[model samples]
Target: MHDRGRGHERRPVTQHVVVRWKAGLPRGRDEPWFLMTDLERPARRISEPYARRMSIEELFRDAKTRRNGFALRAVRLKKADRIDRLLPIVTLAYILLVGHVRLARRTWTPGRWCSNNRPNECSDFTIGPALLDQARFKPAAALAAIRKATEEVGEEWG
Candidate 1:
């Protein structure tokens, strides 16, 4: 495909590999993923990079999305220093939520979604409520985990 109208200032894009990768594997029920890249490699090797890219993209989605994850998108931290600090804190919270999903899978009961218990279906979204319900259960451990995660940041206080 050639474009002569808009984006003419950019370099020409040569033929690229396009594939329909099934992201919801093990279940194989989700919609197909459309991936395109100009890596100039064999078709078989293309999915490797795409898979990693999708994982990273999903991480951002889980961090920013309001309905399913941390809802960090709503936060407004203008300064670069604040953003840097907030990222680590938010990441720690996200990790805690995902961790809750694992523990909740064993102890807490989930609602029926026309199917029986399937751990694959569990995610940070499902555990957000659990985190809130048990937020007061263990404060010291949560603080310890948060401090451990932020140790490399080198921020000291009294």
Candidate 2:
């Protein structure tokens, strides 16, 4: 298989697959994703898992940088036991942050403070930074905003 970089050595692989590009700028031209896999699964099955994995990778990227410094801080801790204990707390915080962002997107207006270029296409990853930018950093304020959003949607938060 040939890597995208010029003058790179060609490496042998079990399979080389190209999937059609889906999302991008309206007039922008982009290359299809080049995938190398060892699994014997059909192309249709492979695409689903690969797409899911990419979403998860994006989620982790947001958690580390935008939502919280989870990756940066975790690496500094010396104790394994502390790391184990910290994992659940960090996971819960991440879940709460994502949930809050999802709720806020439905409840709050993009107004003049939207960080995303396309607010309608915003997800938990995009909304988290936007929420922080809007100074909704406190848990109580965020929960209140979520409650307000749910109310607007005529849904109750249980």
Candidate 3:
């Protein structure tokens, strides 16, 4: 196939692989993925990283639109210098937020905000309510409160 573009010609295809798998659907549909790569590694090796890229993309999407307003404000900046300065701050904030979410996931229960109506759907973004709930009580105090409530309700804290 001939593909010409502005200022450049299309590079030759170095590697092409088609991966197929059965989709986990009730109808048992077949899902096919086409991957083109220039790396010397095996198809499986290249495909692993390609598959993992979805999570990275999701994280950026969450940071920009779903969770934090990181990239949304960048549109207003007309100067490259301002954008360069802002990127580091946004990246640092994203890292801190992810760290906080990981910690909160370990210590706290999933809140109402984390619930989705779709069955088996889970979210990587979970810091919102966890931070709010954590702010209301210390770990020890929260545990004590839970114990007291359970005792009063004639149920054991498990």
TM-score-based ranking = 2, 1, 3
Per-model tally of clashing residue pairs: 0, 0, 0
Give TM per candidate.
0.48, 0.52, 0.47
lDDT of 2 by residue, 109-148 (tens): 6653354454545446565655765545567655666666
Query: Against the true structure, whose lDDT is highest?
Result: 2
Query: Candidates' lDDT values, in order?
Result: 0.60, 0.61, 0.54
* Lowest lDDT 10-residue stretch of candidate 3: 116-125
TM-score of 3: 0.47
Better of 2 and 3 by TM-score: 2
Off by over 4 Å in 3: 1-47, 66-74, 109-113, 116-158
